[model samples]
Target chain A: MKGFKTQWSPEEADRWSKEDYLTFVISPLIYFLLALGAIWSLLLLWYGWLTLGICGLLLWLMIKIIDPKLKAISLDYEKKQKEFLEELEKIERWEN
Target chain B: MVSFAWLDWFWLVVFIVLMIVCGVLFYRLGKRSLADFFLAGRGLPWWLPAASVYATHSATDTPMWVSGVIYKYGLRGIWYTFFSAWCAISAFASTRIFRRSLAYTQAEWQTLRFSGLGAELLRGWIAGWQVFMNMFVLGWVGMAMGKLCHYLFNWPEWIGLMLFSSLCAIYVLAAGYWGVVMADFQQGVVAFSVIVIVSIWGIVAAGGPQQIMAKIHSLGESWRLNPLAFSGWTSGDFPLVWFLTMLVIAVIGGFGMGTSIDWYPEAQRIQSARTVRDASYSIWAGSALIVARNSLWAVAVLAFFSLYPRIQDTAQYEMAWYRLGFEFLPVGLVGFFFAAVVAIHISTISTHLNLGASYATRDLYQHYFRPQATDKELVWVGRVTTLILLLGSFLYGLMMKEITQWLIFALWIMTAGIWLPSILQVVWWRFNAWGYLASWMANLGLSWLVVWVLPEFRVIPSLPDYLQFWIMMVLGALIYLPITFLTRPEDMNRLVKYYVMSRPLGWWKPVREEAIKRGLIKPERDLIVGGQP
Candidate 1:
């Protein structure tokens, strides 16, 4: 680990920031549900049976909880990130 | 009954005139300074941002998507992703949060909160990923439009793709965010007015809403009540659990400002709004768009299905929309119809390009190559970065992964990995950073494993998607929650500073004056570029 005197690297911060943007933090479940619905749609076509409805409801129940959960985590991330920034500011501040 | 052929021509002229006017206006403003070019100099008001949100989001795929559902599932079709509308609403509701923060783009938030290498790394990765996704995934949207045009107008896909991309890129690249926002407003108006007119004409042709319902009833009960009707009931063909998962994925995985953070125009546009009220109002207006945008498409599609017998191929399915416009509407109206679709395509493409490139320049290039860059220099780099983005996106268009499947499945999976833990931490006060990280990585690793190890899962006797959704959420939460307490709490001083500066409501202890006087702490009141903290 770097010593307490180490200065912050904007480059590293930017790298993580880019990762944050591209990570798909929130949409995988949507695509998964789409896949499920699509698969069930195919099933209905092949066998003339209706199943996506049942599966869809269950999927909805499962994914619905995650949204609020995502919000909570995001809020927390903001909090932590805030704290981290503040701490850095303090350590980096010159007497001037 | 309808003999106003000039209305069509008039609307078409209006749209073209408006678009050209937008180009001209941007050309003028764009020449002034970088502020005008990139962020409209933070001078944009509520309406333009709201209009951009609506216009850029109302893509060509959406209409076909709505029709697709109705063609297959009936009224239940509306429920397919209708929950996303709530996401739009929530985004607006929280518009103040973003605007209040005063960051030009979401990536800038990384600097405000995390200053060191961690922040830089975060910024770089998120920006790179956003640009990459926009450059790659969004190109397909234009390509799809090309495919649609080819089906309808007998043009080649490449021909239409090049034409569409060139138009959008030319103006967007030339004008930057300033021009795009103005153009987006015009696009929104055109899209709304045209769709409404087309919808009225459709209703008339379908013998009105009552007849449309009657025809739907003729098909089956599911056609009427089943699409958006259920709440719960697992294991059945249309179980509540599956419905629940769909809703969860929409919010958690799809909507929660996760996954595609770069795709978030809300924060950026809000930053440019003249005031908090303007920002909030613009966001709220955008929220209202969710009410009918998707459903409108579904309604249009179902109405179309009511007329057509079979939707055999993708080409036929997409073409039928154009055919309806061409067949039912008169000359000017026909032109409006054409313009609206093209407008939607351009608006979306422009947004993706601008958003993606902003990340590349701001988060990656600026953060790394020139942290000391002047505003003038940064603007040039941003412009050059956009050019590089265009080339990369073009390449992505030519050769890439099978997003056809990702489009169907992986989008939300990526969201779960990218966003869930971070979102969870914000609300659950006890959720430590380590726990959030664990949740993110755990979800990602397991999901990745599923894709790699379980090809058969794709099509077994029935590996239920709901089952996967349910299991993943359950396991992800279960694993992450316990880990929260296991990790160290965030620094207390930093917490206090954030609450004070951002004025976010929280329970951390207030900063004392003695601490500031002693030079042991920084005051929250003095934090814009960087807090005294």
Candidate 2:
């Protein structure tokens, strides 16, 4: 609760599941992919299939750079929340 | 002369009534205190501010601007919108940093970061600049709405400007930011719905996406589909080098320089989020909407191109978007289109009026005139100032014939010179008020001298706006660095407080040491990096 300011309380983070993470990551990707797909189609229509391969490669590169960072941040956030909960449990046991 | 169907009139009147009712309802919420009035008491859920951000940015001119760019440059013109999209990156990285600072106005942020006459001067200067900038934006959008009205109904421009603006001013005056955000939610939905509906209609009318594609291919311009399409350095209106240069400036100006670059509206949105995570998430949500909005505009423009392949009239090109409304929409839906345009204008103007009033009331009035003023008095002042800003913007809007070119130049070129100072203020401890003052003044003076005066007089050969922008940025930096060193650094206590609170990453060694010495933060071997407070 104290280490960093986050909108997600420990309780909220603890409640988050793999589905939540996947949803969070995929939502933006849907928009991103749709936009890129529309643009790529235009490129392919005008220039031919070769431009598709090039754009696909660039998109893959972008996903490589961006996806891992998003996952890592999500994982790190959960890890911090778990650690924080453990600390809270220890304090509660001691007080009891 | 344009004529509206009865159904169009019905939708327009209904939407106007809906917004006024929402404003009157939120009026009670804003009556509580300064924080409540100006910030919704900083307890808003992430989505509200997110929607507001998207709505506020999608001004009356936004589609016209996008359509104009697409008209001129094809699909690649979307990059122009990318200029502000960089703020989403900033949101991911630094949204909480801004939230944790807890400054009401970015101007008020000075006192938290510095001390002495320097802080006072910096605050005053920022407050003044924010007011002017907000007015400028409101006027710019007002002018667009005026033009839109004239094109839509053959009505006088002022009639359209006054009608929508007065409606916006009344609600904002009654309810403050509470009215702005709540109304923005409805406005954003209407605006975005109209955009999507109109785009789809145009695409269908153009024989679908596949058909539209076939049409584009028939025209056969090599650069038409190329995202990297740009004119060469010497001859074109916007050259390849210019786009690349502007990209660098935008990235540096936003992510590197630390300016939200929405002027102050985006910062206010960030601050309004209830929690730090909410603040950051709001940007992503807002950004997604913005991206979708632009893409939708591209679809409509593509359809426009397909329908009218050889139009040569310049004004017609600019008005292509309005033409689509008249051409494609059903009678009732056409009214919805006009209503949506009004919604866009209201969304933008309301935020600016509310924000401009905050600067005048909180930063200028409360800080200087009545530090001991009660909440009731402050709220009263905020309402009056909102009305004043609305009037000022309307007056200024009437004075201008066209603001599109001036706007492009200001955002793209004039702002390039100020980004460094904005960035350095957060990241560097030694960046004092004098440095900020010098850099901004230098940016304005040198930019005017080099870009305008020199070129007009032929003292130097005229260059493209992008090239002029880069030159201004470099000279502005040249002036900024020496002034930073020449002036004394901000007070040690203030620097340490800023460091401990904001946790900005950069040349903050002295402040970090002081924070450690004062036992404000635990000493660590690894320095805090990337503004992680």
Candidate 3:
């Protein structure tokens, strides 16, 4: 929370930043933990609960870090989407 | 053999009708245009495609595959299923980039990414290959269903294959992907709920988790409980080296397109989402559900191992999950379980039917044959291709017995050598189309040599799969990297357009500078100056 950027302008969000890299690391760890945690917890193992608890915290942190950037990117990108769609159709029809 | 009660028949009939009707209800929406039929007009919020992703990947053979591994290798075998974890990083990376590109299929993305003759050739080759590959997949998955039905009702395998696939094609023909996604939602729920219920029943049947653990411990196999159990560093089947290779392939693969076969269908789902964020979350959440689901099955298989500890035959133990449902669940609930199997079976069928049709219609017919086809005409073409793919699957399914070995070789050819080139094409601005094409060609010949031909001739020893991957990657780079530097780069104009639109990550400095010079995107310095952060 301290180092991660919580707010982003459209242009700033368009570039790759530390938030993206942090997510690239965090996302896979959550997947690994979720798999191991689910099985271990189903067996009623205590460490399984601890693993899952950590996974939840990591997931929340990942979202907090990346969601604002994504929101900014999506908002700005949608405005140009119509023009892009038109160009795509032209390419599809070999008119480009 | 299992016998169905009247109530069981009642459950099966009602569920089949509900699934078909749920899909057909979207008929009006699907017929509105080609986009509606193939992509639900690109308006889905995230959850719809998320459920579709989960349902599509959870086929009839999935439990069998999971059961086989967990039974043979215990908890360590979960890594085999972890290949889907590619979506973990992909959700934030390539999924975002691909969503921005607006390409309907990966084949089409080739032409968008590269220019001129080589790009056209790549697009055509990939499109044709995808059409064939989807048919092959349909056959593979359909035959798995056929095998399951034969095991259950003593029906001929062909009857099981043809009957269910034809039934699923009804909605797919009427509604296309709209039908596939909607039916997948219901089917995903049914299959997941029943999986949970039956796994719990199986665990209880083994006298609960505590008892199961006690039995395993008493049998002197406590290592089975350890998820991190390694046989040795590199000698045994569950080697640490293999695990590290799998982690690299599954996680780092997210940065590239087409790193796995699953990327093809997922590309469609990525585009169907309403926004980049929606697309990202859909892929991430869908795969999260898959990872969670595999854990449930892994534990259930362990329970089965505890109950019947010495099933030496692979075929018999592979039926562990299905046996837990039919051999354990009550009479009426057994029927409900069968209905869920049908749900599982056809959800996969519907997705492939529609997916194969998308490649056939969008890439082949519309782009190459009739580029000016009206939306209405394209929608009809989609239906016709859907019918063609369904019939083609039936033929492929019937002949699968003889071709199974060859199909495995074909899959290896697609994956091992082309993996890095796929990543480079996405992340490196200078990875021209010829380089990518050369990798595919080199992999085809080298896979045969390294995997089979040389080994058969005693020219080299049979290597482990992990070793083969690294060797092929290095060998493929030998060919493609030189070809990349030799050939002219993709036209700067096309690269700039793609860069501005997709904003791809990694090694894109030259293209970014050009985009900045052209005023297409603001410079980083300008952004910082204007932002007041």
CA lDDT of every candidate: 0.56, 0.72, 0.91
DockQ of each: 0.03, 0.06, 0.72
- Number of the top DockQ candidate: 3
Better of 1 and 2 by lDDT: 2
Model 1: how far is B487 from its true place, Å?
5.5
Residue-level lDDT of model 1, residues B182-292, one tens digit each, is 888888887887777786676467665556656767766433423445534765455667667666655443223353332366566766676555664565456446435
Which of the two, 1 or 2, has more TM-score?
A: 2
lDDT for each residue of candidate 1 in A1-96, tens digit (9 for 90 to 100)? 111112222212211122222223322333333433432342234321233354345434433433332333334334444454344333323110
What's model 3's TM-score? Answer: 0.98
Instruction: Give the higher-lDDT candidate: 1 or 3.
Output: 3
Worst 10 residues of 2 chain B by lDDT: B524-533
> Pairs clashing in candidate 3?
none
Best by lDDT: 3
Comparing 1 and 2 by DockQ, which wins?
A: 2
Provide the clash count, candidate 1: 112
